[model samples]
Target: MQSNTVDVFTIGFTQSNAERFFNRLEKAGVRTVIDVRLHNTSQLAAFAKADDLAFFLQKINNIRYVHQPLLAPTDAMLKAYKKEKGDWGVYEGRFLDLMGERKIEQRLKPEMFEGACLLCSEALPHHCHRRLVCEYLNDKWNGALSVRHL
Candidate 1:
């Protein structure tokens, strides 16, 4: 293997049922699920509720769960993006800027991503910050991690 080639994954539960979601992670050999959301307990989230997910992941799949709010966009940023009619390009730009300011490179380590999956609500990666998180980490880690959007 190369010097540091960590395996990182990203998954969204919007289009997936609880069973399918857990299946995906298990199939991918995911050991950790890093939740990148501002609020993980939203009613719309249902079974994916932070505490419930944590328990289910561990009990059912043996996957550890961690919520990293720093990876989520601020409420203000989210509001602005929605106000723009879901312009993904603008949201991407603004989110990237926020990530830079947060110095995500320094804050997150390759170890935190090894066999880990980034979780969010967007069914597709196109409009999700989890995709950006993967891209940003892939670049910052100098290709040290392989990111797969599940």
Candidate 2:
């Protein structure tokens, strides 16, 4: 991604206090939150289901939520990763296809907001698929993308 062109931030809810997480997001002025978890359900009750979380987000006007199953890493990808680089290359390739062929960038790119954040259950970006996703986006955008952890 080009230096100082656009910024992309990755954040996780892993073991973090939910209230603090949401509050930090609010403080960050994120307009759109994309949930990347293949299984949106979490063992933790607060982040368990998407519907309830979406409803809570709706209460905060101007904040939108979306889930992209295409972007989510599949079981097959996980299994393959175990035997391969385990760097999420396969999933990143699929994500690029979705963004390019499926026109996900055109359909879901944030325009009204200054920033967006990808959401998942893991708190560490490097340990999560969001790192690969961010790397893909960074390459696609030709270094115009920046990633920050929140």
Candidate 3:
């Protein structure tokens, strides 16, 4: 690990199977998985259910799992984007504002993100808050964080 560089990874479980997901994390040498999902307990993905994911992560790869709801968008915000067909630009603006208002950069420790993977439901980071979170933190920390999407 570089003294001045903090490496962070991001991933989405959607369109991924248990084998591929776990293997990817293991291959990436992830030490922890920080779930950034608003509704993690949903039945959408059985293996990704909060309890099951934690258990699987530990049992399969010995990786620590944490659910950090503060990293997720609010239910209303998500609803507007998904259910109401709101524009991505609007959603992005609102989410970024909310993160600033919540002061996640101050509340979340940079050390915790070292060797950690941010987990979301999107198959790709393009439209995911996980990507925005990484960019936001990198900006706040003066590009100290090196983010890699897996």
Candidate 4:
């Protein structure tokens, strides 16, 4: 790895079982798993529940877990997109604006994300805020982060 490059990863647990998820993180050399979900304790996210997931990650993969709701979209934004079936473009724009407002580029230390994987509930990264967060920060950091989806 280049000295100036940050190895950042993003993953979603919805379509995966616990075995696959933990194995992927372990294989990817992820040191920290950053929970970017607004609500991680939902019953639907069984294997990915905050407490249990953290415990599993440590025990199984020797990985650390940290939840940062600051990287998540507001509840209203999620409801509009998921429940109301709102436009992706509109929701994405609002989310980008929200990220700008949060000033994550300034607030989140880059060192914390080094060798870190961003976690969400989406099955894939294309439509997930974790992807947006990665792209946004990479831009801010002049492409210093090399983002990989797992």
Q: List per-prediction Cα lDDT, in the order shown.
A: 0.88, 0.65, 0.93, 0.91
Ranking by lDDT: 3, 4, 1, 2
Better by TM-score, candidate 3 or 2: 3
lDDT of 1: 0.88
Error of 1 at 91 (Å): 0.8
- Per-residue error for 110 in candidate 3, Å, reads 1.6
How does residue 142 of candidate 4 score in lDDT?
82
TM-score of each: 0.93, 0.71, 0.97, 0.96
Better of 3 and 4 by TM-score: 3
Instruction: Give the C-alpha miss distance for residue 130 in model 3, angstroms.
Output: 0.4
lDDT of 1 by residue, 33-78 (tens): 9999998996666779999999999999999999999999998878
Residue lDDT tens for model 2, 60-101:
536677876755666666556645656655656665564466
Which is the winner by TM-score between candidate 1 and candidate 4? 4
Write the number of the candidate with greater lDDT, choosing between 1 and 2: 1
lDDT of 2 at 80: 65
Better of 1 and 3 by TM-score: 3
C-alpha positional error of residue 127 in candidate 1 after TM-score superposition, expressed in Å: 1.0
Best by lDDT: 3
**Per-residue lDDT of 23 in model 4:** 90
Q: How many residue pairs clash in each candidate?
A: 0, 4, 0, 0
